[model samples]
Target chain A: MTNSNSFPAIDQDGYLLSRTDWNPAIARQLAQAEHIELTANHWEIIELVQEFYREFELSPASRALVRYTQQKLGNDKGRSIYLMGLFAPHPALLVSKIAGLPRPANCF
Target chain B: MKSLLCISRHSPYGTAIAREALEAVLAAAAFEQNIALLLMDDGVWQLKDQQQPIAGIQKSLARNLNALEMFGVDTVYAHQPSAQKRGLNTAELCIESIEWLDDDQVRQLISNHDHLLSF
Candidate 1:
C-alpha cells in the first residue's frame, strides 16, 4: 500500500519507490561530489524538497522552486546566491539538481 | 529555438536587481521561449511573503513574482542554505516552493540551458 504521508512509497512487495529518493548517505555522496560542506542550510533544502513533493506531487523546476521558497521565507533570507551557495557554491548546477528537472538546455 | 534563464540574487526592496530580473523573465516569456528563473543567495528575498515598499522606492518585485505564472515562466529555484542564513524559513515567505540545487547541479543547469542571463 502507498502511504500518502510518507515521502517514498512502497509497493505490495515492500520495495521503496520514489522519483528521486536520496537517502542521507546518497545526499552526502552527492554533496561531496559537489565539494559542498553539509550544513543546516543543505538540510533545509532537503526538507523543502520533501515539502514540495507533498504539496505539488511533483518536483518543481528551478524557477518555481526559488519563488516558492521566497514565499515561504521572507525576502530577507531568500537571495539567489545564498540559496545557490547551499547546494554547491556554484549557481547553475544548484538550480538543476534542486528542481529535479533536466539541466537548462543552453547553459554551456 | 531560443531559451532564456534569468538569475536573481538580490532582495525585493533593495536595489532594482530583483525587479529587473522579473522584467527580463517576463520579457523572455513574452517571446514564447522556454524561460526559467532561479533565485539563490540574496535573490531569495524577492519571494518574501508580505513586502510593504516604502514610498520612495521606484517599484516592487513582490508584485512581479506574483505575475510570473501569468507570463508563462514557471520554473523557479532557490538555495536552501541561503534562506537559513538569513533566518527565513519556508513558511515565512509568500512565493512557491523552489527546488534547492547544489553547486554541481547548478553547473549542469547552466550547461543545459541555451541562454543564461544574471541580474
Candidate 2:
C-alpha cells in the first residue's frame, strides 16, 4: 500500500493539487481516504470523469456530471442516485476529488 | 426561471473574456437556469474547429464549448455578419446546431432574453 507520504500534494479538501499527479493508484488511495473501496463500477465512473476533464479541460458540476455520464455510460449508470450511492453525500464533489480533478467550479 | 442570454464578443485565447463568458453560461445551466450563448464580433472565432492551444499555456476553448449542450445550454446563436467579416467558413465551425443570425435577427434575439450578459 502507498503510504500517506507517498501521495502527491493535495488541497484542503483532499483533491490532488495537480491533475498530472493522478493515477489509478493515487485514485485508489484517495477513495480510501473517503472511506470508499475500489470496485469496477467505481472505476468506470472515475475513468469517465477523467475523460471528461481531458475533453473539456474543466471539472464538471453535478448537472454536467450526470449528463456527461448519461451520454457516455447510459442511463442505468448515470442517474444521480446511482452516483450518490457510489460516492454518497455529494457525488460530484467526492468523485472529482477521488479522480484527482480540481473541485468542480459549480459544485457548491 | 429567468432566461439569460450570454453574449460572448471576444476571441478565444486573446484574453480570458471569451472563456469566462462560456463558463458563466455553463454555470447558469448547472444551476438549472435557462441559458443561451450568443457568439458575436470576435467571439465567432471561438467556434472555429482548428484550434490547438499551447499545451500548458491555454485550454482549448472549442472543446470547452462542446460541453455546453451537455451542461443544458442548448441554444447557441452566432452572428452571421461577424463571422462573414472574419471569413469564418461554416465548414470550419467546430459545433453543430448553431443558430446563425443577421443583424436584425440578432437585435431581436437580444430583445427575447430576460437578462443579457456581455463579455
Candidate 3:
C-alpha cells in the first residue's frame, strides 16, 4: 500500500507513522513535510545512517555520524556543515526519521 | 525567573551528553528561566572550530550552541584553563559569545545561581 497524501501517525516531530511500514516513498513524503528534496547525497547519508542503526542498534548522534560517514562515504562528504544543510533544522532527528528509524538517544 | 547554571563537562562528540545538556538549557530558557551554560574541562572541546561530526553519522553540536543565544541564554561561560589546556583561545572557539572564567569567578558563578545543574 502506498501513502497517497495522508501520512502515517508521527509524533509531534515528523518521524515515522509506523516504524515498520517504511518505504522509500514514505521517506520522500517525510522529506516533503520538512520541505527538503531528497537528492542523491541526501539518500546516501540517510541510508548509511539507517544502516548504522541496524548495525549498532542505536542512532548515531552528530559525532558518530561524522566518523562513520567519513569511513564509508569518504572525508569530503562527512563534513558537518554539509550534513547540516541537507538535514537542516534538525539533522539527527530528520535523518533518523527519513531513514525509517527511531530518534537517536541522547540527542537534544 | 529562576537562575539556573548548567555545567556541560563532557567531550563534545563522544556521546550526546553535551547535546542533552544543551536541550535542557533550551527548555529552561523556553520556560523563561534565567539560564547560564558553562563549558568546562573536556566540555570546552565542544566549542572548537572546524568540527565535523556528521561523518560520524551525527549532527553538529555547534548549531545547538548557536541556538542558545536566540533562546535568550546570553550568559554563557567557558573555563579558561580548560580552553588553554587544549591550546585554544577565544578566537579558535566556535562560540565567541561566551566569556572565559577563572577559579574565583567560577566560585562566584556557582553562588550566583539558585540551582546548579551538571551535565
Interface RMSD of each: 10.3, 1.0, 11.9
Error (Å) of candidate 2 at residue B28 is: 1.0
Cand. 3 Cα-lDDT: 0.79
From the highest lDDT down, the ranking of the candidates is 2, 3, 1
Which residue runs does candidate 2 get wrong by more than 4 Å?
Answer: A1-5
C-alpha lDDT of all candidate models, in order = 0.62, 0.89, 0.79
- RMSD in angstroms between candidate 1 and the native structure over all alpha carbons: 17.2
The TM-score of chain B in candidate 2 is: 0.97
Instruction: Please rank every candidate by TM-score, starting with the best.
Output: 2, 3, 1
Task: Locate the minimum summed-lDDT window of 10 residues in model 2 chain A.
Answer: A1-10
Interface RMSD of 3: 11.9
**What does candidate 3's lDDT look like per residue over A5-86, in tens digits?**
7667776766674567788998998889889999998999988987776554456666667667877888887777878989
In model 2, residue pairs whose N, Cα or C atoms come closer than 3 Å (at least 3 residues apart or on different chains), thus clashing, are none
lDDT of 1 by residue, B40-97 (tens): 8898777687676663335445655655664466778777777888888778776665
lDDT of 2 at A44: 92
Residue A94 alpha-carbon offset, candidate 1, angstroms: 42
Report residue A21 deviation for candidate 2 (angstroms): 1.3
- How much is A44 displaced in model 2, in angstroms? 0.6
